[model samples]
Every structure is written in structure tokens, then in C-alpha cells.
Target: MFYFLKQRFSHLAIPEKNAKRIGMFRTLCAIFGGLCVAYLGMTLLLFILPVSPGESLVIPLLFNTLAWALASLWIVLAPTRLRALWRSVLPTLCFAVLIVFFFFKESM
Candidate 1:
């Protein structure tokens, strides 16, 4: 059974072991990276919104799911595994910094 399966899919681009590792890496990146990006993106959205606190939470919360899906898709579709990680990391960091500054300004 295993032999027949191997022979059936032998023409795949990546070698067997490497492909499995890469697939796992991509999956991890998508899951964790998407969460980071989505959470940060939602907080960042708070700064842009002009509504009161009660109403403001609603929009970002609503958009969170959609943002997570898009971020996950973006990372998965990246040409290289590392690039997929970077695509998620860079924006997350940017959002973090912006949130920090917003809070700092509010404190001062």
C-alpha cells in the first residue's frame, strides 16, 4: 500500500522528507503568525476608529476573523517559507509599535 502510494505521487516538486517539513513549517507559521497579525491589527484599528469605546470594540471584533483569514492566506501563498513568516512578522511588529505609541501618547 505505501509503495503504491509513493509511486503514485513520485512526480511532486519537493522531495518527500523536505516537503513534509516545509508543509509543517507553513502550517505553524499560518496559525501563530495569523493570530499575532489579527490581534495586533484589531488593536491598531482602534486608533483609526472615531466611535466611542462601546461601539469601537464591535467593529474590530467583527473584523478580527476576517483579518485572521486573510493574514493566514497571505502567509500560506507566499513563494518561500521564510517569506511567509516575514509577511506575518513585519506587519505584526509595525502594529505593535503603533499601539505602543498610541498608549504612550494617551499616558502623557
Candidate 2:
């Protein structure tokens, strides 16, 4: 199953530009960068929202899951195309923001 998925994504995989094998630094950087972006985006949304304490808890969980699922799908299917990744990300972010805005507006 793993092999099949990898094969399907072979075209989207980045070609190694250097002879050096994957190193710890590169792996760490990728993980950290992804986490930082996710955290920063979530934090920004949390501040903009005016939810009650109980409601606020659910918002982060829902948004994070939705964002991560979308991001994971894009990473798996469009890895080679940075533009495709950005295009996917922007819409998801906008959707999250819109949801928050409406939720707050309705609560008021």
C-alpha cells in the first residue's frame, strides 16, 4: 500500500538536487516549519475571535483538524507544485476566517 501510494506520488516528489542523502536537519526543518505556520495561523484566529470560553475550545479543534486534513491532501497530491500548495492553503485559510466571522456575528 505504501509503495503504491509512493508510486502514485512519484511525479509530485521533489528531485534531489544534491547528492547528499536526507539529513536530520532537513527533516527537522520541515517539521518545525509546518508546525510554526499552523500555530501562527491558529493563534491569529484565536485573537480575532470573540468566542465564549466553552465555544473557543471547539473552534481550535475543528479548524486545526480541517486545516491539517486539507494541507495533508495538498502535500500528498501536489508536492512538486508550490503554487498549487499556496492556492490550496489560501482558500482553506479564507474559509476558516469566514467561519469565525460568521460564528461571532451570529453570536452577537
Candidate 3:
């Protein structure tokens, strides 16, 4: 099974180990993590910066989209498999923490 998939995705430019098993999982993590980080970062910026409503809404959204793209690129280009996972996962954890904090704050 591994050998079959290894050769299958070689042409698609996916690494063997990645394509053989965990490629989809890695891709999902990177994509979703990037989105999560973007939202979290946007929220933080909105709270910290004293911008007008326009700037607050537009700038953060732009930055968030850019961050997502950059993060996805980083994951694909990382040299090691674990590095790719961690790069995505670490940001996700950050987002999770921020979300928890926001929820906790709201409950108070």
C-alpha cells in the first residue's frame, strides 16, 4: 500500500512519506491552522490597536489573509515532515489559547 501510494503521488510533487500516509492530514492542519491564526491575530489586533472602525476591520482582515497564505507556504516548504506539522500546530495552539481567553473574559 505504501509503495503504491508513494509512486502514485510522486508525480503530483508530494513527498513519498507524506503522500504515502499523512499528506492530507498535514495539508488540512496547515490550511486550518493558518485560518485559525489569522482570526486570532485579527482579534488581538482589534483589541490592542486604537484604530477607527474602518482600519480595524480592513487592515486586520488583509493581514490575516496574508498570514494564512504565508503559513500555508511555510508548511509546504518546510524541510522536515515534523517541522511542517509543528509550524502549523504551534500557531493553532496559539489560536486556541487566545480563543479560550476571549471566552473566559466574556463569561466574566
Candidate 4:
């Protein structure tokens, strides 16, 4: 079954040397970039939830673990290395911007 799937998806496979590089790239993105995105996501969740502070904090705190896990897997399992990089980076950047905007808005 695995072999059949591999053959079926042969066009998606990377060369051996590039496989290692892409794997490392995905791993690094999953760890560092995913974490950044997850953390910011949690913060954004806290801000977005229409609940009291204590309840909101608890929800994102719980969600952070699941969010990080999903983000890591999402990055690592993307179709290509570039896709993985974007999957990790784009969300992180967007979340960072939203977090900044929320903070700035709060200050104003």
C-alpha cells in the first residue's frame, strides 16, 4: 500500500539530498516559526473571545498546546518546502501584526 502510494505520488518526491534539506527546513519552521505563530494565535484568541478576562485566559492557555501541535504538523506536512515555509511564516507574520494592532489600539 505504501509503495503503491509512493509510486502514485512519485512526482511529489524530492531528490535524496534535497529531501534532507527540505526535512530540516520543515523541522526548523515547525519548531521556531510554528511556535511564534501559536503564541501569537493564543494572544489573538484571548483578545477575540467575548468573555471575561479569567475565562479568556484559560481558554487560550488550553488552546495554545493544541494550536502549537497543529501548527507544527501543518508546516511539516505541507506539500513542498516553500509551501511549508509559507504556512509557518505567513500566519506568524499576520498574527504578529494583529497582536501589534490590538496592543496599539489598547494604548490609544
Clashes of each: 0, 0, 0, 0
Candidate 3 residue-wise lDDT, 1-108, digit = tens = 999978755544444554345566567767876777778777777655677656788788888888888878777666555566677778778767876786687579
RMSD of each: 9.6, 10.5, 7.3, 9.3
Residue 84 local lDDT, model 2: 40
Candidate 3: give the clashing pairs: none
Model 1, 1-108: lDDT tens digits are: 998768644533234354335576677889889999999989988877878767899999999999999999888766566676678789889999999998798789
Q: Which stretches of candidate 4 lie above 4 Å from their native place? A: 1-22
Model 3 backbone overlap count: 0
lDDT of each: 0.80, 0.53, 0.70, 0.80
Clashes of 4: 0
**Which residue runs of candidate 1 sit more than 4 Å off their true CA positions?**
1-22
Tens digit of per-residue lDDT, candidate 2, span 1-108: 999978755643554455355434334333443444455456556656787656676677667656655454444343243434454456556656765776687689
Error at 42, model 2, angstroms: 1.6
Name the regions of candidate 3 deviating beyond 4 angstroms.
Answer: 1-22, 52-55, 98-108
TM-score of each: 0.77, 0.38, 0.60, 0.74
Given candidate 4, what's the lDDT at residue 7? 75
lDDT of 4: 0.80
